[model samples]
Target: MAVVLLLLKTVGVLGFISLLIFYLKKIRLYRAAAKFPGPPALPFIGNAHVFVGSTEDILNKIMELLDTYPSPLRFWLGSRLFFGVCEAEQLKIVFTSPKTIEKEDLYKFARPWLGTGLFTAPASKWRVHRKLILPTFNPRILESFVEVFAQQSEIMVRQMKVEIDGDEFDVFNYISLCTLDIICETAMGVTMKAQTEGDPTYVESAKRTFEIFYTRMFKVWLHPDIIFNNTRLGKDQRECIDYLHGLTNDVIKKKKLELTFDSPIIEDTKPRKAFLDLLMELSNEGKKFTDEELREEVDTMMIAGNDTTASVNSFVMLMLANFPEVQEKCYQELCTIYGANINTDTVITHEDLHRMEYLERTIKETLRLFPVGPVLVRYVSEDLDIGGHVLPRGSSVVIGILKMHRSEKYWKEPLKFDPDRFLPEEVAKRHAYCFVPFSAGPRNCIGVRYAMMAMKTLLATVLRHYILKKDRTVRIEDIKLKADVMLKPVEPISVKIERRKH
Candidate 1:
């Protein structure tokens, strides 16, 4: 009986201490941020709890929460304070000063999967790596990848033939494999077995990596002490990253041998035409690039180049399936433009993409409605004067990118998936900072042109050959975005396809 009494007393004391700690955290952190409009936070956890469902909806909720609380909205995530930056003026202040006003620590949690790649590295290294690799991504050579883009896209079209008989099709896996193949070929100079021969091992690893990443980011600790100490990555996440890098490194080594050839792309004397080969050339005869630097740049490119493009494709496939009229329009345009020669060997030039304005608009509209990366973040490196106030050092300044895409100030019908809104003349009227499918300021996505070309080419080819119709059970909002590396539908983007009219 005495022991039972002692145990009850211990429980009471623990509860009291928890309350006391909550009080101190509120007073020290949130009260200090009370100047900003925001929802009241619980002791340790903040808005992090609301991220349990579809990726886009979770971002929509974040946008709603910010709208409810306006600019400089403050909240907590496990005793840590975070601010949701809404005002355009404040976004400029933060994005333009990535060297000072912010860093990319949001990716710290992603390190187990991506190492110190461009997204995870510090400003100094990122700059060096950026400058060194910038030339390889030059728009001039971007035309070269068009054929590569067309090839893999045709492969996807061939695969879709089996499901084109009014049967439901899950596009999430197909689009991922397509982009994975493209990136593996173009970025690493090697084609993944998954895309070429229908192997599922690489595909499974990639999906599991993303799942574990999400779990680590949101799962509440079993106890308090577990939160404060260094939280190491799960074994699976580490293995996934290792396998990805090992595959890339092998490809880079193989591509280096052909750099001695005069022309990287010629009729008879074959040379490596991939971006990885380009990086190898710069690494060998360079003032700045070393072996390690070369690997890091390739690593960054490989990781960034694959998932985001795939996510965009996955999103558009779902949208096209749901909107039959829009899908028909796109299909008709493809017939007029590319005719019937859309296959794995299709070699489209950059100029060809420019002619497909309707195609571009469809891709742009998809990005506005369902951005592959919904939120863009930065950590304040120094004191930043934003909007009306100054942010202290070490503070994080986050932009609701998906919110801005839907901001009423920028669109006539913000929620509608109307591609016509992006007409050349109409595009000029929108705010320069708004509509950031790839983000903006100096840190705007460098792969913007490449991503656009790749996506448009694939979409045009698909529309040319097949008519996409959504499964009756799927709604636009019903497609949950379960994302880790990049945004993807939580459920498969199931659609029925029919061979298009010639």
Candidate 2:
């Protein structure tokens, strides 16, 4: 009896010590976070309750918080500290600082799919892979992709003819499928025919996988691996990932086989290289990238390349549809380049893409207002000062790209969709960090030039062939947005297209 009592006392003492240590650490974090402004948080739970809602509701709540709180604002997700940094100056420090190079913890959810590809790789691994991949996206290499972009775009245009002179339909699906085809052809050297095939397993699996990732991110219950593994969502995600990984593996294997057999051929007579072709070449020579590494990087390229560009292109089309005047201007610019031959189906060349100064500005403006990455989350490795406030080390910093883009302090009528905001004189007036659609700093998107070229080529092709129209008068405020892996509308972005008159 005495021994039993002693054992119970011993267990109680250890438990007490553990509790005390946890509280002490918590107190330190609480004190550091107390310096910033935010909504009053509940103990233990902090502001976690606010995140439990539909994706659209979650986005609305975030926008509300952005409006209420000043820049360098604080909030907590369970025990983790988060600071919403929206001011351009504050964003500059968070982005450019060497100490803050790592992505936040939530990015780990993507590791299952991306597998430490450039998007989710550790800072050290990212540095090496980034250097290795940089040469593949050279301007000359990307210029070669214009033919594929224009070809895939023509397919999308032809498919949309079914909707011409008919009632409005969602244009986002058509744009996404077109982008998927482009990415598959350019990134994997495989013609996905996503537009022609109409929702293949690969495309469907990828779409569901992104939704699953975003769902897991906000739902705290799904954070634990053991619990999530037992759930239906987790099972579905696993199947999707397995299929995706298998597809990438098959592609890599086929390319390796082709390279092995084709080594005797001369370079000039060979086919134009895809990103995967370039990567495989490096892998074959000097044993650079492993089989796994190749898969990771290619999967990253497929998702990153297809999704962001598709979202921006869809929104740009929606914008043009809503604003007829802007559509007219864009069409006029295309006319000048194509020489008033509206019906002519000429392939968009790299030289032709550069002449699209006005269209480029329009795309930039769309990015500013509805950036596909509405928020960028980075980790603070050490105590970091943003403006005057110090973010405690290990805290997650959520850079509110949406808020920064629309801040009244920086933009004139911030919500207004004015492509003129990107005019040379107007651009020179604003802080560079205020308008980061591609993000900024050492980790800015590597695919910026590639994406711009693809979007311009695709948009130029479509505008040349059709006139965009919308059923209802639209405003920026009218579009209800949802926060997912990407920023998208709650409802489909619908528009009508008419065959352009010659």
Any runs in candidate 1 off by more than 4 Å, and if so which?
A: 1-32, 43-61, 98-101, 218-233, 256-272, 339-347, 471-475
Model 1 per-residue lDDT tens digits across residues 1-502: 9999999999999999988987775564444576777776664566567655544455556667777877787765565566787666677777787544235455676665566656667777777777777787787678878888888888888887778785786776787788878887888777684565886556667667666655555444512324523345465666777886677667666665555544635523534367766776666676466655566667667656777787788778777887788787876675566666543344666777887887778888999878866776677666677867666555566678767777787777787789998897887886666777787776667788889999988888787777787657354455555446456666666778888654
Per-residue accuracy of model 2 over 72-98 as CA lDDT, tens digit each = 788888788888888998899988998
**Model 2: CA > 4 A from native:** 1-13, 266-268
* lDDT (0 to 1) per candidate: 0.70, 0.88
Q: What TM-score does structure 1 among the candidates reach? A: 0.84
Model 2: pairs clashing at backbone N, Cα or C within 3 Å: none
| Model 1 residue 365 lDDT score | 94
Highest lDDT among the candidates is held by which one? Answer: 2
